[model samples]
Target: MADIDMAELGPDRTLLLVDDDAPFVARLARAMEKRGFLPETAESVAAGKAVASSRPPAYAVVDLRLEDGNGLEVVEALRASRPACRIVVLTGYGAIATAVAAVKFGATDYLSKPADANDITNALLSRGEAPPPPENPMSADRVRWEHIQRVYELCDRNVSETARRLSMHRRTLQRILAKRSPK
Candidate 1:
């Protein structure tokens, strides 16, 4: 993705990035900083809420699930402190239900995980306009595989539980899990 025009980001460049994945968050913080944002980062919902309450950043990128609590709480806190704050919610386990809930809770946008810094920047700076289509969208099979993998991890790698939750035969789930992820 190309660099965004910082002039369009308005006068307030403060941005808060909250995610439990420390390395990923750190990397994103660096990337955002290079994009002309004054970035602050938090690794959990509590920290995010605290920052939002005390500082009230003008922009935010938050992971939907955290070790301590839901990211929506941070979004709510940011909105409460700065009503015009641009907040984007991200999750590996993205679903329509959660996306709707995030928006209702005050997020400006919701994106599936593995979103790059460019994607996030566009989301943050968008002025109620839909973004252009992805340059190379994931294939349907890859999407399904990724979703199944996420669910499988969430189920603690229990094949029976994962299969039961997905309503697939145990053997079939096992086969799918064993295969390499599709492109």
Candidate 2:
């Protein structure tokens, strides 16, 4: 496959990527390196913060959930360490509240998991791509909400039965669905 125009990023720059998924960290780091960036990978938020604090990077791609803690913490830490560094948050669970909170906390953008190297590279580059839409087909929130809404509606908004069908706690299901807004 052809590479992204690294010029879109306005000169190759250093990038810090924080994700606990080993394969994803390696794959994305390699891809960004090929795209003319010097990318660093961290398997945990603590390590990511350490790298950023020790030597600031031009950009950071942060995962929202980490083995040790929330990736948002890492983003905050990066911002504090290097106020100029750009940040993007990736998560398996993409809620609007979480996404909006990420932006409020200083992420330049947010992406859901299954995002490819190119998507991440573009985010790091600040190339003007919109934050991944909450309703996007790849979005975990859309998929989970739709499924829960279907069951809830089918069960006449009966929280217990809906939760049972989904194999989740009633309260957890309620919280998830509560975050859903009316169309």
lDDT scores for all predictions? 0.94, 0.80
Q: How well is each residue in 55-147 modelled by candidate 1, as lDDT tens digits?
A: 999999999999998999999999999999999999998899999999999999999988999999989988888789998999999999998
Q: If scored against the real structure, what TM-score would every candidate get?
A: 0.94, 0.70
Query: Model 2, which residues run further than 4 Å from truth?
Result: 1-3, 127-183
Clashing residue pairs in candidate 2 are: none
Off by over 4 Å in 1: none
* Model 1: lowest-lDDT 10 consecutive positions: 1-10
How much does each candidate deviate from the true structure in C-alpha RMSD?
1.3, 7.6
Give the per-residue lDDT of model 2 (tens digit) for 1-183. Answer: 336666666553888889998988898888878878888999997898899789878788998988799888888888898887888899876689999999888898888776887777667665565555434353565666666776787788899998898889988987887684433
